[model samples]
Target: MHNTALQSWGDSFRAFVHPRVITMLFMGLSAGIPILLIFSTLSIWLREAGVERSTVTYFSWAALGYSFKFVWAPLIDRLPFPVLYGLLGRRRSWLIIAQTGIIGAILWMGFTDPAQNLTMMAFAAVALGFASATQDIVIDAYRIEAADADLQAMMSSAYIGGYRIGMIVAGAGALTIAGLFEAEGSYEPMAWTVAYGCMALAMGIGVITTLIIGEPTVTRTDSKYFHETSDYVRFLLMFALTVIAFIAANIYTANLTNPLKSGLIDAGMISELAGFIAGTLKLAISVAAAILTAWLTTKVGVTPTGMVQETYIAPVKDFIDRYGKAAIVVLTLIGVYRIADIVMGVMANVFYTDLGFSKEEIATVSKTFGLFMTIAGSFLGGLLSVRYGVVRILFLGALLSAITNILFAIMAHLGPNTMMFAGVIAADNLSGGLATAAFIAYLSGLTNISFTAMQYAIFSSIMTLFPKILAGFSGTVVDSVGYSWFFIGTAIIGIPVLFLVVLAGRMMQINADKQAEIETKT
Candidate 1:
C-alpha cells in the first residue's frame, strides 16, 4: 500500500514536465492575453476615458466571437491552410495564423483612441475577439490531439495555469504599465497606446512557440464533405449567407424588442430582467435565421444535402446519440454553469473603480495576488475531484461559487475597505478557480475524441453564449439597482444551477450503471 501510494505521487509530479504539457503553457498564455483586453480590462480603459457605463458594457459584445466560434470550428478542424499546411502541418499552421491575427488586432486597438473614435475601437476589439476565439479553437484542438487520454488532465491544468498567468500579464501587467505612463487624474491616450503596444509584442511568445512545436499527428475521420473544389466554395458561401441572415435578423429583432424592453423598465420591471428578455428574443430570432439559411441552402443546392450536416450537424448528432433525452438537460447545465461568475465578473473592475480604488491597487490585489489564490484553488479542486469524484466536487464548487458572491455584496456595502476588498477577491477567485477546474473536466469528458475540435468548441461556445449575452446588460443592472443589489441578484441567479448539477449527476450515474450492465451481459 505504501509503495503504491508513493508511486502514484511520483507519477503525478512527473506529468507536469512532459514536453507537450509544457508547450500548452505557452499556448495558453497566448490565448489568455487578448481576452481581458477585449472585455474587463477594456472596460476600465473606456470607463476612465469617460465612456458611459452602458456603452462600456456594450463593448462586451465585441467579444461575442468567443461565443460564436463554433460556427467556424469545423473549418479549423478539417480545412487546411494552403502553403502553411505543407510547411508546418495543420495545427501549427492555424496556430501561427491565429496568433498573427491576434498581434495585428492588438496593435490596431492600441492605435485607435476609444475617446476619439469609439466605433473604430469597437471594430478593432471585434477583430481581436475573432482572432482570439480562433486561436482558442485551434489551441483546444491541439491540446486534445497532442497527447493521449491519460495526459489530458495534466495538459488542461498546464493550459489553465498558463492561461491565468497570461491574464495576470494582460491584467496586472498592462494596468501597471498604463499607470506608470499616465499622470494622476489625467487620461493620456498615449499611455494606453504604449501599454497595448507592449502587449502586442508579447504575442511573439506564442508565435515562437508555434514555430517550435511539432504538429500532432491527427487521424481525421474520412469525410466526403470537402473532397471537391466546388464543395469548399459552396461551404464558404453558405456560411457567409447564414451569418448575414443571423446578423440581419438580430438587428431587426433588437429594433422590435427595444421598445418593449424600455416599456418594461418603465413599468417597474428590473433593467436586468428586461435586458435578459431582449437578449433572449434576439437569440431566438438569430437561431431562426440560421435554420432558415440552412434550409434554403439545401433547397437551392448550394451544397449537396448532408454536406453541412456532415460537417456541423454530425458532431452534435454524435452528442445527442450518446446522451439521448438527457442531452437537453446536460446542455442547459453547460449554458448556465458560469452565469454567476461571468455576470458579476464583467463588472468587477468597474466596481473597484466605483469604490475609489486606484488602478494600481486593483491590479495588485485583484489581478496579481488573486491569481495565486486561484491557482491554489485549482490545484486543490483537481486533487479533491480525484478523491471525492468529479460530480461531488462539481456540486461543492457550484455552492461555493454562488455563496462567494454574497461576500461581494457585503463588501459593496462596506465601501472601499481595502482589507475587506482583498478578502472578497481571495474568496471569489478561489471559488472561481475551483468551479472552473471541475467544470472544464466535465466538459472535456463530454467530447468525442473523433470530434475533438468541433465538439469541444461547441461545448465551450455554448458554455459562454448565454452568460456573455446576459453580461452585456450588467451595467444596466448596476445602474438600476447599484452594486450591492446587483451582486445579490447574480447570486440569486445561480440558485437554479445547483439543482441542475444534481440532476446531471444522477443522469450520469444511471447511464454509467446501464453501460456497466451491458458490458456484463456482453
Candidate 2:
C-alpha cells in the first residue's frame, strides 16, 4: 500500500533535495530546450527575417507534433532500440536517440536561411518539433519509472523547475546571444545562425546527463507480441500504413473543403472561424480513416488487433468506465484549460517586437524576469492546493488566467512602456504558474494508477491539441482586428473556461463523496 499521509511543509520542501528529484530536473531541462526554439524564439527569428505574419503563424502548426505524440507513444514504450538497448537499457537508449535528433534538427534549423528558403526552414522546424516531442515522451516515462509514487509530487516540482530554467536558457539566453551578434538597426541571418548553433550546443547538457544516469530497474513480463521480432515488425508495418492513410485522408479532405472555406470567408464569415471549421472537419475525417485502416489490419492477424486494443482502446475504455457520462466534461476541461495562455503566448514575441521593444528588452523583461515570477507563482500554487484543495485552486487559476489577458490588452494600448511591460509580465507569469500547478495536480488525480503513464500521455495530448490549433491562427486574428482586440478576444474566450472549471469541480466533489460512501460500506 502507498502512504496517503500528507507531509508537513518542511518535509515537502526538503524532498526536492533527493537525488532522484535532482535527476528529473536535468531530464526536464533536456525536454524543455527545443520547445521555445520552435515557437516563441522561432517567431522572433521569422519576424526579423521579414517572414509574413500569417506565414509565421502557419509555422506554429509544426508543434502539432507534440499534440499528436500519443500516436507513436506505444512504440516508444514497447519497441526495443537495436544496439543501444543492449548497451544502455530501454529508457536511456531512447533518451540518447531523441537528444541526438534534437541536436541535429536544431543545427539544421541554424544553418537554413528562413527568408531565402522558407520551406527548408519549415522542414527543419517540423523535424525539431517531432524530435522534441519524442524526447518529451521518453522523459515523462523515465520520470515515472525512475521513482516511487510518494515522491512523484516532489519530482514533478523539480522537473518543472528544471524545465523553466531550460526555457530561460532557450528564451532569454538565445535572444541575448542573437542580439549580441547582430549590429543595431539591421537584421543579419548569420546572427540567428550563431544563436541557434549555441542552443544546439546547449543540448549537450541533456546528452551528458543521459550518459551519466543509471536506468530504472523495470520488472519485465514476457509478452509474446513484444518479445517476438516478427510480431514487432508486423505491428510497425500496420502502424505505418495507418499513418499513411491518415495523411492521405487529411490531404483529400483539406483540398475538398478549401473551396467551401474560401467561399464562406469571401461571403463574410470570419476567416479564422472558417479555417477552424474546415480544419476540424479534416481532422475528423483523417481520424476516421486511420481507425478504419487499423480495423482492416485486425483482419489479417490477432497481434495487431491486440496491440491496438492494449495501446489505445483499453486506456480510453478504462477512463469511460471510471467517469461514465462525466468523462466528456473532464476531457473538455482538459482540452480548453490552457487556451488563454497558449493562444496568446504564441504571438507574444511578435507582439513585443511590433510594439518597438528590442530583442534585448523583450528578453530581459518577458523571458528572464518573467521566468522567476512564474516559478514564484508555481510555488504559491502548490502550497495553496495543500491548504485548500486542488479543485478550488484550479478554479482560482482559471479565473486569474482569464483576468490576466485584460492586462495584455491594457499594455497593447500603453505602447511599449517598459514599466507597463514589466507589470504585465509579473501578473501573467504568476497566474500562469499557479494555473499550471493546479492543472497538473488535477490531471494527476484523474489518472487510474493502472494506466498511469498512457492515460497521462493521452490527457496531455488532449490538453494541447485545441489550444495549438487555435494558436496557429493567432496572427490571422491579430491581422483581422489588431492586437488590442485580439487580446480582448482571448480574454473573452476564457470566460467559458471559468464556467467549465466550476462544473468540473462540482462533478469531482460528487464523485469523491460517492467514493467515500462506498469505502465506508466496505
Candidate 3:
C-alpha cells in the first residue's frame, strides 16, 4: 500500500512538467504585474511627490478592491463575455476583458500627475486596483479548474513563481526604470509615468497567454435559484449586511484614524475609550450584524449549507456548512495572520527613502536581493510544510514573521547602513515568503473543490483586508509615535495571530476526530 502511494505521488509529480501546467507562469505574471505598481511602488512615488504620509497610507485603501473580490468571483466563474465569449470561451474571454481593462487603467495612471492632481491619481490607482482584482478572480479560477488535485499544487507554485517575477518587475524594475528617467536635480513624475506605461505593455504576456490557452470545461452544480423563499431571506440578510458594511466603511472613513474618536460617536448608552472609537464601533456593529444574521438562519430553518451563496453571488455556503461555527475562528486567524508584515509593507519604500537611501538602493538592495530571498524562502516553506506539517510550519513562520520586524526596529534605530539593510531585507523576505506559503496551503485545504474559485477568493480577500485596513492607519501611527514604535506595534500585532493559529489547530483536530468517528460508525 505504501509503495502504491509512492508510485501515485511520483506519477502526479512528474505530470507537473506538462506544457499546459507550465503556462500558469505567464498567467501568473499577467496576474502579478500591477500589484506592486499600485501598492508599495506607488507609495514610493507618492512619498517622492511630497504627499503626506497619512494620505499616502490612505491610498492603501485602493487595496480594498482585493479584499472584496469575492463579491465578483461568482460572476467571473459563471458569466461569459458578450463578444469575446464565443471567440475565446468563458475563462479566456473574461481574461481578455480584464487584461484590457488593466492596460487602459495603467495607461491612465501613467499619464496622470500625482503632485498636481492627487485625487485623480488616487482614482487611477483605484481603477487599476479594480481591474487587477477582476483579473485575479479569473486567473485563480482558471488555475484551479485547469488542473487536477495533484497537479493543482504544482500549478499554484508556478503561478506564485510568475507572480514573484512580476513583483520583481513592477517593484524593482519600475524603480530602476524611473531612477533612469529622473532628471539630474529633481524627482520626475513623467519618469514614473513612463515606467507605468511599460508595465501596461508587459500585460500583453497575459493577453497572449489567454488567447493561446484552452478554457477549462466547467459545469455548475448548485441550482442558485434566487426566487426560493430561503434564498430571498438569505439575499435580504446579505443585502442588509452589505448596506451595514457600506455604512460602517463610511463611518470609519470619516474618522479614519479612530472612527469613534469624534464627539458624537456612541454605542447605545455605552461610551467607549477615546482612541479607536470609529474603528471599534465599526468592528462591533459588523460583528454583531454577522452574528445576528447567522442566528437568523437557524431560527428561519435555513440549512445554511450555502446560506449566503446566492446572495453574495459566491459559494460561501460550501465553506460555511463544512466548518460551521469554526469558520469565524478560522477567518479571524486569516484576517490577522499577515498584519505583522502588511501593516509595515506600506511604509517600507517610504522608510527607505526617508532613511536617505536612493530609489536605486531600494530597487537593487531591497527589491532585487529580497526577491532572491523570497524565492528561497518560498521553496523552503513548501519543504517545511511537507516535513513539519503545514500548521506547525505556520506557527514557526508567524514567530519568525514577528521577530523579523524587530530587526527593522533595530534598523530604525541604527538608520540607513547598507549592510544592516541587506540583512533586514533578507530576514524580512524569508519570513514573509515562508508565512505566505503556509497560509496559502492552509486556505487551500479548507476550500471545497467545487467552489474553489469563490471560496478561495473569499479567504484571500479576508486575509488581505485586515492588514490593509490596519496599514491604512500606519501613517497616523508613525506620525504620532514614530517609525520605531510603529514597527514595534506591527510586531506585536502578530501575537494575536500566533494565539489564534494555536486555537485553530486544536479546533481542526476536534473536527477531524468527529469526522473520523462518523466514518467509523458508517
What are the models' TM-scores? Answer: 0.84, 0.82, 0.72
Q: Which ten residues in a row have the lowest lDDT in candidate 3?
A: 1-10
Highest-TM-score candidate: 1
Give all candidates' CA lDDT scores. 0.84, 0.83, 0.76
Task: Please provide, for model 2 over 300-392, each residue's C-alpha lDDT reduced to its tens digit, 9 standing for 90 to 100.
Answer: 773566677776777789888877667889999999999999999999999999999998999799978998898778766766665456667
Question: What's model 2's TM-score?
Answer: 0.82
List model 3 lDDT by residue over 1-522, tens digit each: 001122244454454576655788798788889899788899988888889999999988886778778765765654455678788887788888899999998898899888999999999888989899999988877776775444444455567767999988888788888889997657798898889989998999999899888988755564445435555555456545654655565565555445446553454422323444556566666656555654565457553545444434346666677776777889899889998999999999898988889878997888789887886776566556544567777888899999998888899888779999999999999888877876776777776655766788988878877687667777767888998998888899888888898888887777767878989999
The runs of at least 3 residues in candidate 1 whose Cα sits more than 4 Å from the true structure, single-residue gaps closed, are 1-7, 40-57, 113-119, 178-193, 265-268, 339-363, 383-389, 403-420, 465-506, 509-522
Candidate 2 residue runs with Cα over 4 Å from true position = 1-6, 40-59, 86-89, 110-122, 147-154, 175-194, 214-224, 343-363, 386-389, 406-420, 448-453, 467-522
Q: Which stretches of candidate 3 lie over 4 Å from their true place?
A: 1-21, 39-60, 83-89, 111-123, 148-154, 175-194, 217-222, 226-275, 279-309, 343-363, 383-389, 403-417, 466-506, 509-522
Q: In lDDT terms, how accurate is model 1?
A: 0.84
Q: Lowest-scoring 10 consecutive residues by lDDT in candidate 1? A: 1-10
Note the clash tally of each candidate.
0, 0, 4
Candidates in order: C-alpha RMSD to true structure:
4.3, 4.4, 6.6
Top-scoring candidate (lDDT): 1
Candidate 1 on 278-348: residue-level lDDT in tens? 77888888989987997899889997888877888899998998877778889999999999999999999
Query: By the TM-score metric, which is better: model 1 or model 2?
Result: 1
lDDT against true structure, model 3: 0.76
